[model samples]
Target: MDTSFLDSLSDSDFDLDLHLIMGKKSSQKKFATMLDSDDTDSMSSSTSSMRLDNMTENGLSEVQVGKDDLLDQCLDALYEKRGSTREKALASIIESFNSSLQNEFVETKFATLLQQCLNSIKKGSAKEVALASHAIGLLAVTVGPGEKAQEILEESLSPISDALRIRPETSKILSLLQCLAVITFVGGEDPEQTEKSMHIMWQVARPKLGANVAAFKPSPAVIAMMVSSWSFLLTTVNGWALNPKSWQESILYFSTLLDKDDRALRIAAGEALALIFEIGNLDKFCGENKDSSEPTIDEGKDSRKLMYLHGLRTKILGQVRGLSAEAGGKGSAKKDLNSQRNTFRDILDFLEDGYTPETSMKIGGDPLNTSSWTQLIQLNFLKHFLGGGFVKHMQENQFLHDVFGFTPKKKLLSGTEQRMSGSEKRMYKSPNSALSKARTQLLNKQRTLAQGRNAGHFAVDE
Candidate 1:
C-alpha cells in the first residue's frame, strides 16, 4: 500500500460512497490520471516553499528544510507522477538530511518538527493524531543513533514532560514519548543513552507520582495513552533486564502507572510486572530473591521489603480479574475493544492460565458478560490463552455446561440430508435404516405415554 497517497487525502475524502458510484475500474483510472498530472508537482513545490518560509520566519535557521515539507513533496510526487519523479523526490528528501546536516540541525529543527508533530497529535482528531505519530516515528528512524541523537532525544523529552504538567491530558504526550522511547531503545545499546532516558522517566514520575499526590480523573484518551506508552516501555525493559541499573527507575515508573484507576492502565501494568518476573527482575521486586553473589539481607528486619512482591502480585491478579470482567461485560467501550481483549489474553498467557470452561462459566455469570464475552471471543488470545488441557478440564466440569448454556454443535455431514454418491448411499443404507426405525419407535412410545396420561386424567374427572 502506498501510504503517500493516503497522506494527501483526509479520511472523509477517501469516500467509499464515491468509489461505489464510480466502480472500481473507473475509480482506478481517475486516480491514475490525478497522479499523472503536473498539478501535483506545482502543489509540492508550493507547499515546500511555504513551509521553508515559515521555518525562517520562526527563527528556525538550523532546519533549512523540514521533514514535513519533504514528506509532503514525496507524497505529492508519489500521487502525481511515477518512476523517475517519485525516485527523485524521495532521493532529494533523503539527501537533504545527510550526516552533517543531520547532526547540525537534528537537535534544533528536527526536534522542533517532532515537537510540532506531537503538538498536532494532541490537537487533532484520532486519524490526524495517528498520522502525526507515524511522522514522529519516521523522524526518529531518519535521525538515527549516536551521542548527538541521544542528546537531542533527552532535550526533546523536556517539552513532553512540561506538556504533561501543563495539559494534564497526557494521551498525545504519552504517545510521542512511547515513540521516542522505542526509537532510543531499539536504535542502540549505549548505556549512557539508556541512563539518560531512564533519568528523564525518573524525573517525570518522582516528585508528582508519590502517595501524597491527589488523585485526578483522567480522560479515556489519557488512559489509552498511558496504557500504550507503558506497554512499549515494559517490552523494552524486559529486553534490558540483565542490566540491574536500568530496573530501578523503570520499575518505579510502571509501579506508578499500576496505581491508576483505569482498568487498561492496570492491565498494562500487570503484563509488564509479569514480564519483569519472567525476565529475572524478581530480585528487583523481592530483595530476598537476589543472587547468591549479592550480600545477604535479614529478611525479618524489613516489613516494607515484602510490599513490593505483594504489590506486584496483587496488581497482576487484579488486572487479570478486571480484564476478565471487562471482557465479560455488556457495555464495554467499543474503541480498541479487541486490542484490550488481546492485552488481557496476553496477560493470561504470561500467567500460563487458560480460558477454561470453568473460567468461561464465571465470566458468563457477570451481568456485562454478553458485551464483554462477544468482544473477547473475537481476540486470538481467547482461543489459546487457556491451553487445550485447561479447556478439557472445563469440559469435564459439570457446572461449566450450565454456565455457558450449551457447547457449540459441530456442522452436520452434508450427505446426511442430501442424496449421497452411490458408494456412500449403499455403505450407509443399513445403518441409516436402523436409525430411522429406532427414531420412529421412540416417537410412538412418547405419543402413547402422553395419550395414556391424558386418558387417566379425563377418566378421573368424569
Candidate 2:
C-alpha cells in the first residue's frame, strides 16, 4: 500500500490493483469517473483525477499508498506515453489479478469485465475495444472451469447478443465472443455448458453465414475467418452434438463451408466435418458398448457404412470432385494441392485404423450413414490427387494384403563381392549396384600394382 509507488503506476496497473483489492464495482466506477472528468486543460489534471479516483475507491488509507506510490513511479518510468502506459499497466494488472483473485472474485469481477468490454465495443475507440477484448480473453482463461463460470457465462450471452446486433463488424467484439465460446466449450469440458455455448454461436453464426453467402461472393478473408471460427467452436462438438438443435446447426454450417468458393474455407469445413464425425462415433461407441476401451475396426467400419448408406459420402465426394477440377486449372494449384492433401490426410488418418467394409454394413452399425464416412471419401479423393496412385497403392500394398493375407519375402543382394571391387564401384544393372562394382574393380587394379612394386623392391634388396 505504498502511496508513492501507486502514484507513479500506469492507469492499467492502477485499475488492476483497484479491481483486485476493491473489486469490479469500485474499479469500474473509478474508470468511468476518470474518463468523465473534463480536466482536458492539463495532463497533470487528468493523471491526478485518475489517481484520486483510485485512492478513494481502493481505501488504501496512508501507509499502503506510500509503498504503492513508489512502485507506481517505477512502473511509470517504463512508459513515456499515456496510451502505452495504460496498455502496459492494464496488462500488468491483469497478470497480478490473475494470480491473486479468488474464485468468487473471478466469477463476479471477470464477468463484469467481459460485459463491460462488450458494452465498450458499442462506443469506445477501436484501440480501447481491442484492449477490452484482450482483457476479456485473459479473464476467460483465468476463470477456470466450473458451474460458477458457466453461470457467469450464461448471464454474459445477452450482452454479446446485443453487441452482435449493434456492431456485427467489430472484430474485437467478435474475438471476445469467440473467446467466450472457446472457454465455455473447450476449457470447461462441461457438456451442458458446451451445448449452451453452441446455442449462442449458432444464433450469431447462422445469420453471418447467410449474409456472407448472399454477397455476390464473399471476401476470402471474411470467408476464411468465419470458417476458422466455426471450426474452432466445432472442436468442442463433444458436448454440442448431444443437443439435437446444435447438431443440426453444426451440420448446416459445415454444409455451407463445403459450398464455399474458397479452397481454404472448404478445407476447414472438411476438417470440422471430420471432427464432428469422430466425436459422434466416439460417443456412440463408448456409450453403447462400454466393454471396449478403445475404438475398434468394427466401430469405424460401421460408421463408414452408415455414412455411405445415408448418402453423406456422395455429397462430400461431389464437393471434392468440384474442388479437384478447379484446383487442376488454377495457377495456385500447388497451394490448393497441399491444402487438399492435408484435409484428406486428416480424414484418412482418422478412419484408416477403424475402417472395414463388413463392419460398416452391420445393423445400426453402418459407418457410411454417418458424416464421418462422407468426409473420409472426400478427403480420399484429395489424397488420390496429392499422392498420385494413392488409392491403387493402398489397394496393392495394404488393402489387398489385408484381404488376401499375403506377406512378401525380403530379398538379399546378389553378387555382393563383385559389386564392391575397388574404390570406385563398376557399373552394373542398378545404379547403386553399378557404382559398387566400379569401386571393387578400382580397388583390385590398385592392389595388383602395389603387389608388383613390392616384388621389385624385394628383388632389388636381394
Deviation from native of the Cα of residue 227 in model 2, angstroms:
4.5
Model 2 lDDT per residue over 37-72, tens place: 344222220011223335334333322334334224
| Reference-based lDDT, residue 184, model 2 | 55
TM-scores of all candidate predictions against the true structure? 0.41, 0.45
> Candidate 1 has what TM-score?
0.41
lDDT of 1 by residue, 1-462 (tens): 889976988767768767666764453444334333454432221012222333234332332335554444334443333443432333333333321123334444564555555554444433334334444444544444444345445545555455444444344445444555545543434445545554444343443566755545555445544444433333333343345433444444555665555556655555554444443435443333334245547675355554655565555556554664464446656664665666656555544432211123332223212112112221212222122222432233222222223232221243443455544532112112333234334433442333333222111111
Runs in model 2 lying further than 4 Å from the true structure = 1-119, 186-192, 208-241, 281-309, 318-340, 349-462
Model 1 lDDT, residue 167, Cα: 43
Residue 402 error, candidate 2, Å = 38
